[model samples]
Target: MVNHALQVSAALADMQIFALEGSRPFGEAVVRHLGLALSAHEERGFEDGEHKARPLTGVRGRDVFVIHSLYGDATHSGNDKLCRLLFFIGALKDAAAGRVTAVVPYLAYARKDRKTQPRDPVTTRYVAALFEAVGSDAVVTMDVHNLAAFQNAFRCPTENLEANKLFVAHFAPALQKEDVVVVSPDAGGIKRAESFRQRLSHAIGKPVGAAFAEKHRSLGVVSGEMLVGEVDGRIALIIDDLISSGGTIARTARACRQRGAKKVIAAATHGLFMADAETVLADAALDGIVVVDTVPPFRLHAGPLKDKLIVLDSTALFAEAMRRMHEGGSVTDLLAGR
Candidate 1:
């Protein structure tokens, strides 16, 4: 880890770093970490369900970064989120903010990066177009559901930050060759598992085998999984993008255990525990669960999985990005995670 807190100060006296967000805690963290001032606002909702906003400071010609995450529920409408985002970003744009850069950590509709089914909409590109329509000059997001979605959506430059890099380094030392088996929880994550395997193999200086478990996500039908690689008495690291209801994760652990795996640990970017997820995950898994602090903060709540949960901070990551952009440096270098 770097010793200093990376700073992003405006080069020109007129230029400023403005961050707006849905969650006050995440937004406030970005503001404090970057050493920027906040505009006073009473952002609340009316009884009639109308959102009300009052900006206390003028933001004419300042570069604003709207830091909002939309990755929990499949109802991730980036275009819709952008629609609401415009109410905020547009105000700044009209206020003469020099430019608006979207600092969305969890991208919505990222899964629909391509048209796998007939007549299916490619929402990722649509979300990109929405940002452009709402006057976004650039965007910085973490762990996009689909990598190419960023490039396809924006005319301006976009950076796809990885939470995986954080995990690979953080967890590599504790993993033994026989103790760790890189397992993708579903078929959709084969590419991610391959990348993880490569990282682990290079780190350990040995071949790290890969395994993918299949699960059919329908009603009342359990997934009959077939492990493609060996994991007998080995630690299973099951990695995925997000966990909503905990069905896939709980079942993944169960399936891995049935295959004679010694232990199973789950990791993901977004942890949106909607239902009785804590009880499900806590009772099912053999080891722990690691999640990134991207969406709503997880510490504010309590659950059965609290003892087993590890929440990683991403504030420094975004704050560093602010410094890099301000310094006229390469954002790609941060994404490559070298």
Candidate 2:
């Protein structure tokens, strides 16, 4: 067992965590909020695009958490990124370092949870196994697609965090007193939207119901279809887990307007600007957009439409989570976004 460095108190002090970067500072913000010493990193890249990573600080017996956001091309090529991550993890394990936690703000292969399409691999599960094998004592992530993916892959503990608290805080205020309605962009997202609905309803103290839009493989949602619930003339807030292509948001926002929705807003936990997502969202008729900075919100290439996009910090939230975990307290307190 590693010598844990957190100060022992009635409540645990989250400390000694370090943040590394791969063109994003999501982890940097997270560790900074904890007031922990950032781990010293010495990383360089080869002309051929290979990379090397080393920690200059001694971690011999100290609990160490490594934060990285691993996703797709906007993130990196699938296996290439994983290999890079594993290399770093292996380096730590080889050093006889203390327990290592892999903190992924956005788990990459979550959406492909099941082998819905033919000959598809359960990549998320495999990746989880890779983490355990590479010396991860625990795994922390947010809003993964295959919820069961955690259980299947790791021999160690796995925790998934939700962004409901953050969303309700910002979005409820944005749509205040406007007779707002919470909406899910698809049937699959009804659960996420419903969770948001319950929280918003409790906070605003009114009848906040939920609606959903649907599409069958098209980029945009099916047009001219009445929403699953009454959306006519009500301001709509679309809550999604993540935005990769921005198609669903644009489609749902457009459909809401068609159904007499006075205004539309989009919010998500992760802002994954894949392909022309920034462009698509900018052209959509959304009044404003908000996203948690779990996956770094700085890269949105929305031109003038960037002004409409709002980025909120999730670093503080993650930092608190690390604090609670280190203290051996109930992570459940904030699990459902209380």
lDDT of 2 at 81: 63
- Candidate 1 positional error at 55, Å: 4.6
Measured by lDDT, the strongest candidate is 2
lDDT of 2 at 258: 83
Q: Across residues 12-66, which tens digit of lDDT does each residue of candidate 1 receive?
A: 3343554444545676786676666555655565698566443456667665666
Q: Which ten residues in a row have the lowest lDDT in candidate 2?
A: 6-15
User: How badly does each model clash, as a count of residue pairs?
Assistant: 7, 1
> How close is every model to the real structure, measured as TM-score?
0.83, 0.88
TM-score quality measure for candidate 1: 0.83
lDDT by residue for model 2 over 68-116, one digit each (tens)? 7775554456566667777777888787776777788877777767676
lDDT of 2: 0.75
Extract clashing residue pairs from model 2.
233-260
